[model samples]
Target chain A: MELTLGPLAYHWPADIRRDFYARIADEAPVGTVYLGEVICSKRAPFHEPDLPATIERLERGGKRVVLSSLAEVMLKREREATAGLMAAEDHEVEVNNAAGLMDRGRRPHRIGPFLNAYNEATIAWMAGQGATHVCLPAELPGHSAAVAARAARALGVGVEVQVFGRAPLAVSARCYHARAHGRHKDNCQFVCEDDPDGMPLLTLDGKPLLRVNGIQTQSESYVELVEALPELAAAGVSHARLLPQAVDMVAVARVFADHLGGMCDATEARARLAGICAGVSFSNGFFHGVAGYRHIARLGTAH
Target chain B: MTGAEDFSAAGELVCPAGTPAALRTAVEAGADTVYCGLRNATNARNFPGLNFTPEELQASVAFAHARGAKVLLAVNTYPPAGQLALWHEAAAIGMRAGVDAFIVADMGVARHIAETWPRARLHLSVQAAASSPEAIRYYCTHFGVRRVVLPRILTIPEIRAIRREIPCEIETFVFGNHGLMVEGRCSLTNWLTGQSTNLDGVCSPAAEVTFERADDGTMRSCLSGFTIDRFAAGETAGYPTICKGRYAAPHRPEGYYAFEEPVSLNLGRLLPELMAAGVHAFKIEGRQRSKSYVRQVVGAFRRAVDSIRSGHDPDLADLVALTEGQKETQGAFQTKKWR
Candidate 1:
């Protein structure tokens, strides 16, 4: 399976954003790079000027670049931005919401994980609409992903699954990050910038439960599926997406690449990942068809 | 703004029907329309011991139509991989049963209905999360949707602004379980319990839930072995859905409702404002509630609509007792303070 770099779900300063992409383009062993914002529209302007240079640099480095649409399109400006992306000339557009579908028409595009393609019929229908690739939602178990991947392969569409980073648990029109910081979504004042990753939210029992970004809520535990690569490959998945995180992403990509290429074993790569994953725990329970917070390893047997 | 003359006509009163008895009760209680689903993952309220069978759906549709009331079939949940045929079969069965409209959420399912049954009237489910006019228009234009049930996150002014922009009709929740999370976008319960509200129509599946009393004489509601909420000695413990549970945040060391408090949504006081905002239908959201809940809520809303039509205010005090925590709020309708 090939490694694909998913979009940045958080807000970083323009310099950080640019430098992060530059390092990925130069050092990361990722084949496809998805650029642009997928969370809040208010944070787009901070990185819009750097987008062209970053996209050009990635393309110049022999990486396939795709522009991602917003996961939640509520405002008129968001809709217009989607339309503009659909009408763009250079890169493939990943449609995240229904508005993107309206603007895309029959053009070749990619369907993001946020669009809710749960079944084979949905994927086939999207394929009919000229979608060349489909990213399944992060909550799907291994069996469900296998079924979807089989259907997608039959229809000549590539199936991509999220193999790393925190699974996006929810998205809302209201900004929980701003609300936690004592402000409304309308006047969030870019407070989400304060948390480079996301603001951690704890349960009543002092257990870490979730992270609140601008309008998006994510799982507190980062999801890791390195050991599940055999099952994923056997299930007909073509690409494994690694979401950008606040760590040595280049090393992250290299480990996944080495593991996929048979250069390193699962245990060695996992030990290396554990060093950089920080104090946060790694979970693969959703892939095992159980609670997402639990990490169940099925090493010797099929799930 | 909608003038008094136009607002006096009163919007349609849509009620929920989880069981056959609830369906008949809602129709008999003056609900202009009653929505229901088949006993499977085809609908959003796919709880055990609830919903109608195919035979029951046909009978219920006939019962409602014979009384001049409409029956809308809810095929709203997103179908899982290799399981789209179940949703398709449900819609086909609903059409054969002569249902009035199909409430669909997934874009693929909507497209299938639009292509297969071009004459079928379609209503965008709240699970589709079409909060903006552009998103509503996309569904209306692409799938021939006739109406859209707006998500619970918008304010009254926001709904009015959306009404002015979109072509299809608009529906809003009048009362019921307050889903503080964004409709169709939340997966907190699925992350805890294997059952998914998006794919399986269940949030906090009862099969995985256990309420236990602690040694300190307090109550703890656990879902899949995770402590969702801890109730004090006398505090009532409602269903633990993860979102409404009290949680400790960064600065606030003590447990607080970081997301939302356990309260139901009651928009009875804002009936006039909702109608003036150009809402086409008022939906009461308790399909899994009791038959008495269906009767009382449908009857109260019917009376409230009629009272407004007669140019008078409504008396809806009895409905407050039906709330989850015996407390209610307008819930993002009158103000945006909910966040």
Candidate 2:
């Protein structure tokens, strides 16, 4: 099993963003890399100029680079931007929502986690559409991913899993943050940047429920599949995607890579991960049909 | 010499059938069309204890057609990646069972229908989020789209503008639960877990939802194991969906409707105005409702539309108890009070 560093979903500046990828390029131990702006279309221009150097550095470090696309697809401007990204003759592209690519007739691309790939037909269809690797949606339970992995193997498409970071749950045209602040989407003036990770929303009783980005809302807890490494490998998951977070990403990558290589067990990895993470919690509920938040192991709850 | 069959409008009273009995009730209540789906992602209303199987759908179609009603099978959810076959087979089966139309979303699924049934009368599902006339017109121009159920985000005037632009007929939601979703794409359900109302055609799967008693004498309704809101005794609590419930946001410290309240949309009073705006059909919004709800909502809407056509005022107060939140709004039709 190998580790794949997925695209950063937040709106970090050019210096920080460049320096972050620079660290991954020089020192971080990961096999595959997905580099591009996967968030707002406006944010792409800031990172596009520096992408070539980042790609060159990562490629020199023996990593395969895949270009990422937007998550929420609607505006024609966003569509045109994605079209240009997909039309890049340089690197393989990962289709996020499968919007324009649906009728592109014949095009080679990687299907990202946001794209819906649930069963054999979708798997076969993606392979037929030229998907070399398909990252299953983060919401897909572990078993579903396993089943889809088997199907991918038959279709000659590889499967990837999201092992770390806050999983992006949904994207919308309406910016909840802007709407909350009584500002229109066009002139909202970069409010989402306050929470580099995302703004956590609590319930009426003060329990953390969800995190709100620009137009995206995610689980307040970062979903850590550190314990599911053996299970994921057994499920035929070849690549583990480590989503970027505002933490010790290098250390996080080291832990995930070590776990994937079978150097450490699930118990050791969980204990190490606990020390590095911030105030937020972690969950793996999508795997079971139980609550999205129900932890397999809790500190206070007696077994 | 004008007859009902020869009416230029051919205005169909599209109704919802949550149960097998409601299927019969809708047909008997002069509903021209009845729409439903299986209890899975095959339909948007993936509520528990509702929907039908292949045999049930076939039987429902026969029952409707035998009584001069048409069955429009709704296979509307965006088929999750690699799961297009479930939706594809649903379309094939709907056609084989003599369904009048196939309501659909997901460009991939739409492409499948276009390739398979070149002549099938396809109706774009509101879940497709085809809010603009240009978007609707694109579907009509590309696929063999015949009609579209406009999302609840548009005003009546906007609907009128869209009706003028698109070549296909337009269906507007008249009554029942109003989904505040931004149409074809909503991932709030999946954010909590991987299961969603969009992919597998469920919103908050019944199995994931649990009502718990809080220590402060309140009840919490959770979807995918997250608490959205809690209510005191006698305070009505609706089914929990992440996007809908009360929550504390960054700016708003006092907990309130973070996204939208689970209010039902009742547009019965605006039937005359909408028909005048060139809408061809009025859709009732409850497929998970009971047979009695089907009878009550469809019957009241039927009376209201007929009353408008006869140049008389229609009384829709009888539909108060059937709405999801026990309250109703005009949605985005009358004003900017939309979710």
State each candidate's clash count: 0, 14
Model 1: per-residue lDDT, tens digit, B1-339?
001112113479989998989999999999988999999988999999999988999999889879988888999999888678899999899988988899999988999988988888899999998877767888888788888999998889888999998998888998989887778887888888777889889888899889889889899888887778899988788888787777666776677766667788999888889999999899999899998878878888888888888888776665555564477888788777664
Best by TM-score: 1
Please give the range of 10 consecutive residues that has the lowest summed lDDT in model 2 chain A.
A294-303
Per-residue lDDT tens digits of candidate 2, residues B220-325?
A: 8887567877788767777887777889876777887766677778776677788889989888877877777788778877777777778777765655545544
The TM-score each candidate achieves on chain A is: 0.97, 0.93
Q: Residue B170: error of model 2 in Å?
A: 5.9
Candidate DockQ scores, in order: 0.60, 0.24
How well does candidate 1 score on lDDT at residue B108?
83
Where model 2 places Cα greater than 4 Å from the true spot, the runs are A42-62, A297-303, B1-13, B28-30, B39-41, B53-56, B76-96, B104-175, B182-200, B205-226, B232-234, B266-282, B299-339
Please give, for every candidate in the order listed, the TM-score of chain B alone compared with the true chain B. Answer: 0.95, 0.92
- The local distance difference test score of each candidate is 0.86, 0.74
